[model samples]
Target: MSIAGQAVGLFAVTNVDDLLVLALFFGRGSDRRATWAVVAGQYLGFALILAAAVAAAFGASFLPSGVLPYLGLLPLALGVRAAVQAWRHPVDDEQPAERGGPRVLEVAAVTFANGGDNIGVYVPVFATAGPAGTTGYVAVFLVLVAVWLAAGRHLATRPAIARTLSRWGHVLLPLVLLGLGLAILLEGGAFGW
Candidate 1:
């Protein structure tokens, strides 16, 4: 796949749950300032996740070549864990009540809290991507964040859509994560890559 295509897949797979969370926030957002703050918070939180992944990738570059393929296990384990969690606790339609107006920090905290899986998937991918590929992935991912926010906001009032997402997101996420893990493993040992 092309870099943009890969980025889109990675971002979408990882952020399916984020759509619901953002939709919830957007649903409650009456103030322009809070809305923009949520957008800014999303960017800030995602940027931090990307940065940490990049840093880990950089560090991983120094490791032995044989160790690279093993990195795939991280996402695989996460996928299994997520699948088990979803099986154990099925999603309900209960939505979060809007507290007061959410600030940048509050939204950022939420965004960051929700990003553990992103960091796990990104680090191994970035580690293999090298400099230019990493740049392309980051650029595409950042652009997609705005698109995701817009889509979420647009879907906010649609209860049917939200309900569908709540119903299926858990199942879809584990599948995506499992596929990503398999891809990484299959494409592993691309030494010159």
Candidate 2:
């Protein structure tokens, strides 16, 4: 995989950190459930994007050439932002809360927020993966779903662990995002400035 390809993968997979954040801040149960729910949505979203990429790869025309690179910047910025935020705040390491909001919307928003980096990274992946990209893309989605599911369970059961994960997210997520941003800017043809 190219650097951008790796960036996209990192973006999608790195939300383990975010899960940690949600777990720590919200204290599992509602938070944990909410995070996982969002992850489920993320899986669907990524799958759709991957499918589109596959279709494009197979010569089914859809978005323009100029569009993908700009899209790349979105994830680049998102990753960097998440990482920086994590580093700045770190995890509070608190007890879980009994209260949480509706599962679907919370999950969807977070999933969408988390997806910024993935989208940026995936543009290149789609182009590179070619027509058979679905297999690899599917593999990515499955791994993500499994990871979030496990993490969500862990957070729900063990609030402390959730806190620990958030602290790590705070420290590591930003660095990953920053690196991804630089990588995207350098490698993605979409960025001319």
Q: Give the TM-score of candidate 1.
A: 0.62
Tens-place lDDT digits, model 1, residues 1-193: 8989999999999989778667655654547886898799888878877876788788943434455555555556656866897678665557532333445764565565456567778888998999999999999999999999898778865777545544565665466556655555666643334
Clashes of each: 0, 10
Native-to-model Cα distance after best TM-score fit, residue 156 in candidate 1, in Å: 1.9
lDDT of 2 by residue, 1-193 (tens): 6544654466456455556434432332345556555556556555555555455555674755555445445445655655555456445556322333324443343444344445545556667765356466656565666666567556645756655443354444445445644554555464476
Q: Assess candidate 2 and give its TM-score to the true structure.
A: 0.47
Worst 10-residue lDDT window for candidate 2 reads 95-104
- Per-candidate TM-score against the hidden true structure: 0.62, 0.47
Q: In angstroms, give how far residue 24 of model 2 lies from its true place.
A: 5.2
